[model samples]
Target: MKTNSEKTIFEMSVPGRKGFRCAPSDVPAADLPEGLARGALPLPELSELDVVRHYTRLSRLNYSVDGGFYPLGSCTMKYNPKACEKAAAMTGLSALHPLQPIETVQGALLILHETQTILCELGGMAAGSLTPAAGAQAEFCGVKMIAAYLRDQGQTQRKVMLIPDSAHGTNPASSVMCGFACKPVKTNARGNVDLEDLARYCGDELAGIMITNPNTLGLFDENILDVTRMVHEAGGLVYGDGANMNALLGIVKPAALGIDVMHYNLHKTFSTPHGGGGPGAGAVCCVEKLADYLPGPVAAVIEEMTDEEPPVYGLVEPKKSIGMVRAFWGHFAIILRAYVYCMMVGKNGMREIGETATLNANYLMAALKDVYPLPYDRVCMHEFVLDAKWKDAPGIRAFDVAKRMMDYGLHPPTYYFPLIVHEALMIEPTETESKDVLDAFINVMRSIAEEAKTNPELLTNAPVETPFGRLDEVKAAKDLKVAV
Candidate 1:
């Protein structure tokens, strides 16, 4: 039933056409290594027109923040404002090389330094490192700092990181990457960490716990003060994952809640393009006690001619450092985008962002609760977790429901996550989206639910309108059919 539109790749491929030309191999040809080059390069070849049209079709298949209302939970796929892009494209910051001398790139450094200041104030921490290129990298940097701290204090046996079952997958993966065994803490009926279970794990051999505020399931940890008190009393540190910062932003500060360290995802919270950003900027902050172990090339204001000479590139040294996580500095352009977003949205605007985000989520929960089941019945922070167990009762899984959403011209909300709740659908309708857009999403979901009960087959084989049908996911992952 599918036609050229579906198989555009096939039409663009030509056997003997090359759009690019290079000088013929001029250097004397040496004996090649055994089995080095492939017998043929099976790249698709066509006139530029064909290639352009093919890729344009493929790009349309993707559902970006700019394309539609994306309620992807915890990921914060909210619209990255166009202003961020404009600011990042300025030649002074965007066009400069990372290796340019600090003196030469002082303008870029000042922007970076100002960003660090904002992160410190936002997280209520003593200092920050803009060197982490992504949230995962930031987490690794923070964990390594923890590792170095433990080694210095001669508590090398503190080799375990406690993660909540409702935590992001990166929490455990990052812990394992840092050479620590992971201990999973269970969630209570309310979706917060079970305090009794947590008490059982905090001891001499535990290094730290990775806590997500407005957790993956979109519920705040009401017991955070008690939790932080317990960890500090037990000689442990806490690492805050600020991936879901679109929720807390102005209403609360993580360090004020007793967190020692945390990383901010500028892409998620500050409207910086993520996938297209190439490399993101993560600002990691910590309490003064732990600041000495932070990763550096720390940026400080120093005297060039005097403390007055426009304070040039000033570097501070930590007594015990974890060394540098990245050479040169982090992505300057992306950080510039975050700085622009922050400055535009000052104190009250930031809090209003949080309030609107939370308000939108609550409205969405009300909009669809009749059709879907909510696992934890509570006031959600910036998102909410809905259960599909009721639909699964008749053999329809969350996976089926998700696929059906695509058929209705919407990107599906995250499904089967947080692990604590069976058949979880994590929906985070960020404040950027309006009531009308939210209604369209809810209506599509409601229609899918009705169809699920009356005709389950539609749910199984979905996205009928897209250029491609349901793919064998494992086959695509394990055995990608590349042309070459």
Candidate 2:
């Protein structure tokens, strides 16, 4: 909801007003290309103080990790440490141009090279390519590599990719983009993949199977080894969507579990800042068997010298590369932040992160299982899902509970996701959040549940405390009234 004092810059504009007073030009006027330039720009006119105040107020209105408890489920909206930001902003690394001479930016090259090494070790892969722009792009890279590998092996007819019913929505899209028809497998009542259904889908045409470990349902597939083995018997590879890697760090290695290829959301799992339309980094890691087919220009050690002299790092293409995914190397600053985060928290710290995150999630699940309907009433990895369909109060929905949270000054969990569960409210209490914060969140949710039973009108007309109440969401979507 908007504060009454806030207005669009345009609305606050006054004619002849100026934020700056520029001196008169003494040199000759510059010529413009014919029809290439415009007359006066339509920027808002305001004093410097007015512009600053307006932006400051707008910033305050936003919900941030720094401001409150943001349990945005699979997104992993944890607090990003300021140390990583400072390290990423260092001029030695930040100012080094991507196209600069290799000899000039040895330190920058070392950072990229070492970061790749750390990620490969962490994900239990022989090599890694940190060039994919985001998680879905990383999935596309892995699937495309599988396609190229199959083509090279003369298996042109192998064009079906099996994805589980509870897999990320991007998995099927990535498969289709890589020229593979998607065959959706079912999720059993226990939340693991249905082995019979998976076996039914596997055949000579099976290109690969893309599975999200510790899947969107927040349950680790216990029979993952068997799932991979079945795919192998059918002559198909396996791709791991490592978006949920936060739950598996230091506990299990995907490669050891027979995952041939996978991608890591460095921004989510490695403590780099994400969300709010910011840039992201997704490092694609592949096992030794598929190392030669990775995306090109992976950070590599070009030369080895004496102990006194450090090893030289440079970009080198894989044996059967898929060419460049992005223009240059990956997002350097994002990679730098993730690298710093890894260094700050060594192997033990990484293990602690996974453990604490899992414990926090289980704690919330135990506290609220009675208040809400727990779809899979088992121990969750790092998140859990709850249903909003109360038996007594039929129409009380997930949206009402979510909106009601806002009235209590708390950001709501992700709602209506994974597509399998009805009215799903996915909550991920990251390790960074404290027990107190989790307790408050749980209490708020419990209170909302009680309100749903006693007074359904409060749930229907939720977020009454905010400046706006009960938005026509469908109409708002079709006719977006966006203000510049």
List of clashing residue pairs for candidate 2: none
Model 2 residue 36 CA deviation (Å) reads 4.4
What TM-score, over all chains together, does every model reach? 0.91, 0.96
Model 1 TM-score, all chains together:
0.91
Evaluated at residue 254, the lDDT of candidate 2 is 90
lDDT of 1 by residue, 1-484 (tens): 6564656465657787766777999899898688997777656777677677777876786778898878788777888889888888887767898767667877777888898998888888898988888998899888888888788899889998999899988888888998999999888988888999999988998888999988888889988888888888888889999998888777788999988889999888988877644578787899887899888877777655465567776566566877888766777778889999999998778888888999999998988888888889889988898888663448788888888888877877888887887888999888899889988888888888888888889988886877568989899889998431
Q: Model 2, stretches more than 4 Å misplaced? A: 1-4, 28-36, 467-484
How many clashes (backbone atoms < 3 Å, residues ≥3 apart in a chain or on different chains) does model 1 have?
0
lDDT values, one for every candidate: 0.83, 0.89
Instruction: Tell me the tens digit of each residue's lDDT in model 2 across 169-216.
Output: 899999999999999999998899999999987899999899998999
What overall lDDT, based on C-alpha atoms, would model 1 receive against the true structure? 0.83
